[model samples]
Target: MSSTPINKPSALQADKASATTSANLPEHISLSKWEDSGFEWAGQVASRSFERLNALLTTEHLQSDLEIKANLYRRNNVLHLSFTLTGEVWLTCQRCLQPIAIDLTDDYDIALLDNESQVRLVGEEQDCLLLDEIITEPAPERLLPLKKLVEDEILLKTPMAPKHDDCEMSVEQFGEIPEEEENENPFAALASLKGKL
Candidate 1:
């Protein structure tokens, strides 16, 4: 949501403290900024917007702890950013369909757009990071929704078949194979008929 992206301002070029205000962030998060890093916040993403993940993965509670660390490198309007996200989500087990709590700690490498351009489509969404400057930036305190990302990842990790390997069918359900059926072959049955005649 920040157009400026974040950059390491030289001591002489540092912008006034206005940028560090809590007003810059959405109400759900608590933010703190670090030098050479943008902003870090830990909280939930959203209930309505993330309904898919909510339905697919049963959260331990409606609440999840999400953390994002991001920083940008800007030179001549070219911006590069790196993010590290950490969080946890509850998922159903593939085998038993039991509750499984999965933790997420992932690192994302990306580049940010310097300004609006026809190339906006190059990296305009969550799937891909845009191309801008040649420099690769890896900074903590990035701006990413860690909770939602982990939720999706956990959903993906869910197994398609939900049968537990250790489970067994009851004896009656197992059913016995008929020994007489196995001993008799069609060819053998024909030979016995010839002897009888």
Candidate 2:
């Protein structure tokens, strides 16, 4: 009988793995290159999720191990951003009144637009994001922060009131239940006095 040895990865190994995954991701990108060459960018980010989320998430103390994948490319004269975010977030369960870990995985897509006029033209018929700065007539070479864009997508997908679907909670969580006993109406006594008069 041959015994096989199991080797566990060291902390350094894990860090290297994460570094390799995030190596290709850029915090910023040139809009001109993205549009002209139809450049494609893909990267992974592992960090404290809530800092990037800002006010979008009401819950605090979310786990620091967040993983997000972003892909940006230009197609059909339109810039497309695709993001996949996965993390264990802490949210106060409405029913349980206890903190629960919610596994979140969101895939979002947005069409990037350079002008407000384009937004008006596109309207709600399409998912569009207007660039913060105007893309001059010739579309000058300008770098856009990819992190901000990715954060916006994550915020949009976060839940407003996160709660467990199967949380076991009594009606008391909402409010005190009224007793079934009926009370004598004050109007009844007034009506009796009026009848005697």
Candidate 3:
């Protein structure tokens, strides 16, 4: 139902209102501008590696090495945003407590709305966000933070408990081996009593 224009350069410039450093990815965007030019972004952002993931990541300062694309275009009075991310990231393996590479790739289609109540006006069945087929977000100021949006998608894809397919750690370290228990037959005691009788 929706399509994103790929490989188009971004016309958006840094905003004077927001404080930004060179290290930070594009943070905020005006939805109006996006709709006007049909914004497109594709590049690798190294600053957003595993180290920047806050408490979700255990290791720090690993290679970011991520490729991302974000496309925003308006269609039929509705604003749509399509995002895709792909790369390899290191995550602390739960099994061995060591860094393991995890393939990161995801894509989402979002239908933008001015407010939450507008969903009622649009009728329930048409909402892409509610159906989970496409995401919908409220745009009160028509401005959104892109950094958070991209980071959130990556975080959602992050493995909650990372582990390697062939774990190098010994089984003993992962779990305790079950000890064998001696079996005693209750029938043996009953037979001994019957013989004495």
Q: Which candidate should be chosen as best, given lDDT against the real structure? A: 3
lDDT tens digits, residues 1-197, model 1?
22244333454134334333322223221122332334333233433245565665654445464554544433334444445556755665665556565555676644444344634534545233333232233444334343344344445544544344565433343667757645556698789899999
Our tally of clashes for model 3 stands at 0
Highest TM-score, which number?
Answer: 3
Greater-TM-score candidate between 2 and 3 = 3
- lDDT of predicted model 1: 0.44
Quantify all predictions' global Cα lDDT against the true fold.
Answer: 0.44, 0.57, 0.61
CA shift of 62, model 1, Å: 5.7
What TM-score do all the candidates reach, one by one? 0.41, 0.57, 0.59
The stretch of ten residues in a row with the least summed lDDT in candidate 3 is 12-21
lDDT of 3 by residue, 1-197 (tens): 33235423443333321322233456666655665556666666663443446565545537565777777765555566677777777768888887877777777666666556446544354524422222235555556656766776677777889998888765555577789897898798999999899
Give the runs in model 3 whose Cα sits over 4 Å from its true position. 1-24, 47-54, 58-61, 115-141, 168-197
Displacement of the residue 181 alpha carbon in candidate 3, Å: 12
